[model samples]
Target: MTDLNSKPEIDAPEGPAPEGLEIVDIVVGDGAEATPGATVDVHYLGVAYDSGEEFDSSWGRGQSINFPLDRLIAGWQQGIPGMKVGGRRKLVVPPHLAYGPAGSGHQLSGQTLIFVIDLLGVS
Candidate 1:
């Protein structure tokens, strides 16, 4: 199970946040690669980019979430595409591609967000 209170270990970006989305591999997997329009199952931890305060986790709930790659936020839609099943990646999402200026819920707003995601499978 995931440790809900644990902060994510985000590496310093090789350069500035890219113009679109940035994905860094934490664990390279040999499973099937994710592609646009594919349904994917994943466990993820979301946090603020500046503070690393965890805001959401699927593992904390003891379950993984499944969704179509094209239906998620622009940042996620862009970043998750090229990952492989069983792979772990860190996604640095700029506000423009995430929730944008409106943000989402109460935890994120206009701030860049970071997510550590584990791709479980693609169906």
Candidate 2:
């Protein structure tokens, strides 16, 4: 069987990124290092910056989701590896790096995303 989850991109951005998100500054991981184009598996909790409502997570995957950091929302792609194993952090990702102008459908449209991430283990 094919693992439909193997694609390494989130539909790609249709045009320029949205109007709010910023890259801040990229931080490197300690031992849990993840390069710009590498994948990082992790556990996380994501919330909407506007409504503070929970949007998505891998915590309920019954295990950690092998989140391909490179393929993830730009916020995560740049934010996840700035941590060490067992480290926790808050990512203030603006929408430009998140879902772009369209915002990944409805849940994220015109909004920045706040994420509380734990660098449980990186593979």
TM-score of each: 0.81, 0.65
Lowest lDDT sum, 10 consecutive residues, model 2, at: 2-11
Model 2 earns a TM-score of 0.65
Tens digits of lDDT, candidate 1, 1-123: 333234345554444545567788887768999998899998888877666667788867878899998888888888888899878888889888887775456346577788898888998
**lDDT to native, each model:** 0.78, 0.58
- The alpha-carbon lDDT assigned to residue 86 of candidate 2 equals 48
The residue pairs in collision within model 1 are none
For candidate 1, the per-residue lDDT at 77 reads 85
Task: Identify the runs in model 2 with alpha carbons over 4 angstroms from their true place.
Answer: 1-31, 102-106
Q: Tens-digit lDDT track for model 2 on 1-123? A: 212222111222344433544433222334665556666666666776666667786664546667667778777876665566545556767767777556358657667676666555666
Off by over 4 Å in 1: 1-19, 102-107
As a TM-score, model 1 comes out at: 0.81
